[model samples]
Target: MGPLQIKELLQQTPDGQSVTLKGWVRTKRESKNAIFIALNDGSTIHNIQAVAAPGQFSAELLLTVTTGSCLKITGQLVESQGSGQAVEVKIDDIFVYGTADVDSYPLQPKRHSLEFLREIAHLRPRTNTFSAILRIRHALAFAVHKYYNDRGFFYLHTPIITASDAEGAGEMFRVTTLDLDKLPRTDEGAINFKEDFFGREANLTVSGQLEGELGAMALSKIYTFGPTFRAENSNTTRHLAEFWMIEPEMAFFELEDNMDLAEDFIKTVITYALENCKDDLAFLENRLADEDKNKPQNERSIPLLEKLNFVVENAFERLTYTEAIDILLKSKPHKEKKFQYPVGWGIDLSSEHERYLVEKHFKKPVILTNYPREIKSFYMKLDDDGKTVRAMDVLFPGIGEIIGGSQREDNYEKLLERVHEVGIDPETIWWYLETRKFGTAPHSGFGLGFERLVLFVTGMGNIRDVIPFPRYPKSAEF
Candidate 1:
């Protein structure tokens, strides 16, 4: 009764004993003499069984209760009936805290499509699939803080509004309160938002790498975990208008150091999740997949411990970007063979190329390094050849690029020239340049797409499902 989790009840010494529980009704079924209720409290993925008998309860009354209504129950926990359920409870008391209109509420007895679930973001969290995801998300986020703080990396917060384009993607969501109807124009035809948006052209931050670097120079190691925005109109299972990113910056580090940190960071997270949220992972593996849908409880496709087994037992592959390109070019798959933009030494890789390099060529999570200078961000350190950038992108088999990072260009003069060459005003970045002016080191860092990593671990198809409120184009429904 004192804030008990469902998993504690399932794996505890409470069977056939009276217990108190509270949750929304996932489903309820009624026969002539009794009523059966499937209830979950978001404490765990498994629903506990509640049975109300004929004399103390009416089947007709139980059937009247809506699926999503909030309720409390005092009952005797019992072993599962012969078929169609797990652990069950014999009801002694039932109190309806809040009533839900069955017809109006979106969720029904039958399954709803993920697309249908996306339209009602607020209600989706109550469903089994979404509830499991949010729990995993909580566990995963906790693992991130634990991973970095244990390594003595300061948790830094960068500004949400910025003048710098950290990704150089030019797809920023403009942070403006100006009236475009009466805009101020310069001497030339180009209109100036400097007098408009926050007295300067400002937009939401795409990455925290720049500010994170400043912290690294001071603290030796630092990481920024926060929301990042992009205005790119990419409609895919992978892209989102807003997402969470974990960017780590380190001093006296190089490309190899960055790779080692990322690899260990991933392994640490997987280990933590398995230890913390075993039941949710098991629910996903056993109950969610269709192939194992009909399999018995012992033979379910999903298992909480198997994900850790997969990540820890198998070594992730590492290859240079050049080698990845070669793999993609030689891939026998039709999509890889007929890429729209032909692959060459200097060309940046397409998502298709990246997926093939990981899923088909290497058949595991792969790290690709040393990209072309013309294709990557300007802040990346120029490799020795002067044509390639000392950058890396960690590509997973299902998700293309889960992270992108590099050793920064710490040369003050070269950094300034890079700013100018990239057509950005040097005045705005004077503070950033001051790091190189005072003290600079050979630092390296990378930004991991947090949701994409979740998708990989859970085998969830869409990026929208992993995030609670997936903000995409033309859809902001709560």
Candidate 2:
């Protein structure tokens, strides 16, 4: 049989059962009479202590064992005499699979700055900080699927390459196979996209929501979780050129229905992480606490576990955009003229404004709805007043807008008018527009940035750090 995972092995009672473990050496120390090695298999944040009498194993074999080296250890599990762990492995035999030179290996037993870790992202997963984040990431992803499946939501795989821009932002990465040095042009002296691979100007999709809506129309409920691209050259802790998005669309659902689903969905996933990833969360919580020790008390964040519990236990505060605007206008920062951006009725709310509502004023998750039509996407259902749309943005503490969605404009005429008003060729997304023409229903959906959720749950500051390999403007290295 294969070797037992450290996670399972740790749970077994110390009944002198023979076992074999294969993992990387985290640390190794040798005394005159005994040698102790802390080994981890990336199965858990905790490591198993393997003890051996001096010269039990060949000196040459033990010499090759170092931090980052892979090994196969045959041992008997027994009660530990040491602290921090319940059981220890008494080594009976050892085999070295591979060795990492102590002098050259980057991941020595040391505290690494997150910035420095980003530079070597390929190896960061082995570190405690990243390992914990990755494990929680997995848990959250699984919970997302489980939540949707339990609710009868069909999983939809949307196209990655398309001719339409869902967000109308026009910042997209073009996908083509034409040679750049010798380009093809039309009689109009423009680049002939007809000769390109897709025979049209196609780009990596910025969102799967538009296509996801089509599925929801037929399936009644659908969700899309996939990679999305943006060409924005943003270098902030919050932005990434490429990221994953979770968008769920539902037919016969209005703005209120959308809000309810989004709130329940987010809370469910957070609860899953808190329950399933206790050890990782504890480690991250301690790590964050240590990091916050140097900060001023007022600026320091609440404990990670408490912050997560706060979100899970409390109901989100819901308010209209106009009400939120009034609150922001009366806020201390706005009244004192400390806000960088002007707070007005029709202006797009910035991250600072959103955070102030969630983190300061509301002190919980806040759902701001009915944004001004001019500041929102054209697809949102226009309200009776013709000033605002049925748009909703769920803002969370630390991270401002975690989910953005709206009730779709089901009226074909209104949708067509809005499509034209936004300067988009109706023919480009004629397939999507056709849904409103033939079998229209009041439908709504929202997109949750997966990395943003990871950032919040993992309590990591940089958006790039949560993603396995972040794709940004200037870098795409593994």
Candidate 3:
């Protein structure tokens, strides 16, 4: 049989069963009579301790058993005398698969700052904190698929590179094969995109919502979970140049249906994590608590588990953008001039404003809908007042807007007009517009930034920490 995983072995009732295990050494402690090695195989947050009697292994072999070293061991499982763990491995034989240089290994057996870990992200997964985060990330991703699949939503793979900008923000990475040194130009002296690879300007997709809508139109229910790129230059705790998006588009769904789906979806996923990732979440909860001890009480976050449970158990507060703005205008922070940005009806809500609405006022997740038309995307269905659109943003505590969606404008004339008003050439997105021309049905969808969800669920303070390899401004290392 293959070597038993540490997670599996830890749960077994130790009846002197001989077992083979393989994993990396996390730490080594030497006593006068025996040596103890903490072994982990990335299966779980907890490590299994392997005890070795001195002289059972050669001194040279013992010297090779350092932190971060990979090993295979044949051992007999027995009840542990330790306080923390239930069982321990009594090492009968040990083999070093690879040795990490004691002098060069960066991850020593100690607490590491998140910033320092990011520098060595290629190897950070070996650390307990990152390993736990990655495990939770995996569980959440699996939950996302299971949740959608069980609901009869088809998984749709949208193009990573396309000619259309889904968000129309113009912040996209260009995909080009044209040689800059010998570039062809139009008579107007602009670089000729016709001479490029696709015979037109192509960019990494900023979202899959537009393509996902086409799938929804045919399939009735569709979801796209894939990498998305944005060229925004912000270096905040919440931004990433390249990230994953979870966009679900449903046909015959109105703004109310969209809101209902978003709420149920968020709650369901969080509940899954709470049930399946208890150990990892507990580790992260303690980690956050320890970190928060240094900050002011008001600045510290609610305990991670409590925050998550509160979200799962409570119903999200729903209000219109106008109502949310009114609450903010009457809030103590706004009256006392504590808000950094101005709060008004036509302005887009910033992270601070969003957090205040969720963390301070509502004390639960909030879904703010019917945003002013000018502040929202052009595809949103316009309200009768012509001043607002059927847009929704789901705001969470600690993290601001976790999900943003809208009921799409189904009328061909209004959509085309909005397209022109936004200065987008109709010819560029003729295919998307053609959907409305042929057989447009009322549809609603939302885009959930995958890293942001991971960030929230993992209780990670920075967006970069949750994603394996984070891409951001001026940094793409490993």
What is the TM-score of each predicted model, taking all chains together? 0.90, 0.99, 0.98
Off by over 4 Å in 1: 15-18, 58-64, 79-87, 180-197, 286-288, 291-310, 331-341
User: Residues 277-325, candidate 1, lDDT per residue (tens digit)?
Assistant: 7767877675456645676876543343554465556677888778877
Q: What TM-score quantifies how close candidate 2 is to the native fold? A: 0.99
Question: What's the residue-level lDDT of 125 in candidate 1?
Answer: 89
On residues 1-478, what C-alpha lDDT tens digit does candidate 3 reach at each position?
Answer: 6777999999999999998889999999999889999999999999999999978889999999999999998889999988999999999999999999999999998888989999999999998789999999999899999999999999999999999987889999999999989999999999999999999999999999999999999999999999999999999999999999999999999999999999999999999999999999999999989899999988888999999998998899999999999999999999999999999889999999999999889898999999999888989999999999999999998888999999999999999999999989999989899999999999999999989999998998899999998899999988
Model 3: number of backbone collisions: 0
CA error at residue 350 for candidate 1, angstroms? 2.2
Please identify model 3 stretches exceeding 4 Å from their true place: none
Pairs with backbone N, CA or C atoms under 3 Å apart (clashes), candidate 2: none
| TM value for model 1 | 0.90
Q: Rank by TM-score, descending?
A: 2, 3, 1
